[model samples]
Target: MDTEMTSEGVAFAKQMLADDHAAEAMGIRLVRAGIGSATLAMAVTASMVNGHRMTHGGFVFALADTAFAVACNSYGRTTVASGGAITYLESTALGDELIAEAVERTRRGRSGVYDVTVRRGDDVVAEFRGNSREVRPRA
Candidate 1:
């Protein structure tokens, strides 16, 4: 697990985000990178707020998902999440910086599993389960 796939893979992921309407709209930023892990952050602005003025759950989910994608794909051979889900345990308020970290869990021949956590300071906001599909690297 490298921070990004390969140098080219990293560039490719960045390029993929160019047309990602949600990524662009949410201002998600890639923060930390590792072979088996990736970290991401997003600011909770009014646009991300829910009716209660707290951060929307969808916004948190997207941040966690991006981190999961990066961590699972860091092998540079192209891995796509096959099956996964997440649970929201707590609400994060707007103006709080949301951070997500994806950690590798298990792997089979062509698939990998991971656990992603979203947090605000010391509070755990959400938990995510991610499954990755490993594919042959493009030459």
Candidate 2:
């Protein structure tokens, strides 16, 4: 396991997400994490279900998005998602467990990139590329 999402790491993410009301309303849980890698899981409730009773894409995105947030800020500083996107590779049912794995790509100056994989068991559900803004020290 990585150090990014250790006991302390989980606490960090919990606080961040708690600050984001929408994320909190979405029921995003910080399942596991390390220094550069992180894993998250969210249950598919009625609010997160699609017409076919499958998990909605937005719900999956939320999980990955939060994982990206945790992984990027795990270093004890804030990082904001500048821009990015995700591609859905498969469909997951209401009871399916979605997993997100995120790792840093690079950080130059004040920006960074993170790659996140969203999966259900062995099947990939979606993939995200996140661009983040590094938080500068307070003046």
Candidate 1's displacement at residue 51, Å, is 1.4
User: What clash count does candidate 1 reach?
Assistant: 5
lDDT of 2 by residue, 54-84 (tens): 7888888888888899888776667789998
Predicted candidate 1 versus true structure: per-residue lDDT over 23-114, tens digit per residue:
77898887766666778888899898988888888888889888888777665667877887989988888789988999999878888999
Instruction: For candidate 2, give the lDDT.
Output: 0.79
Please list the residue runs of candidate 1 whose C-alpha ends up more than 4 Å from where it truly belongs after superposition. 1-21, 135-139
| TM-scores, one per candidate | 0.82, 0.83
Report every candidate's CA lDDT. Answer: 0.80, 0.79
Given candidate 1, what's the lDDT at residue 82? Answer: 87
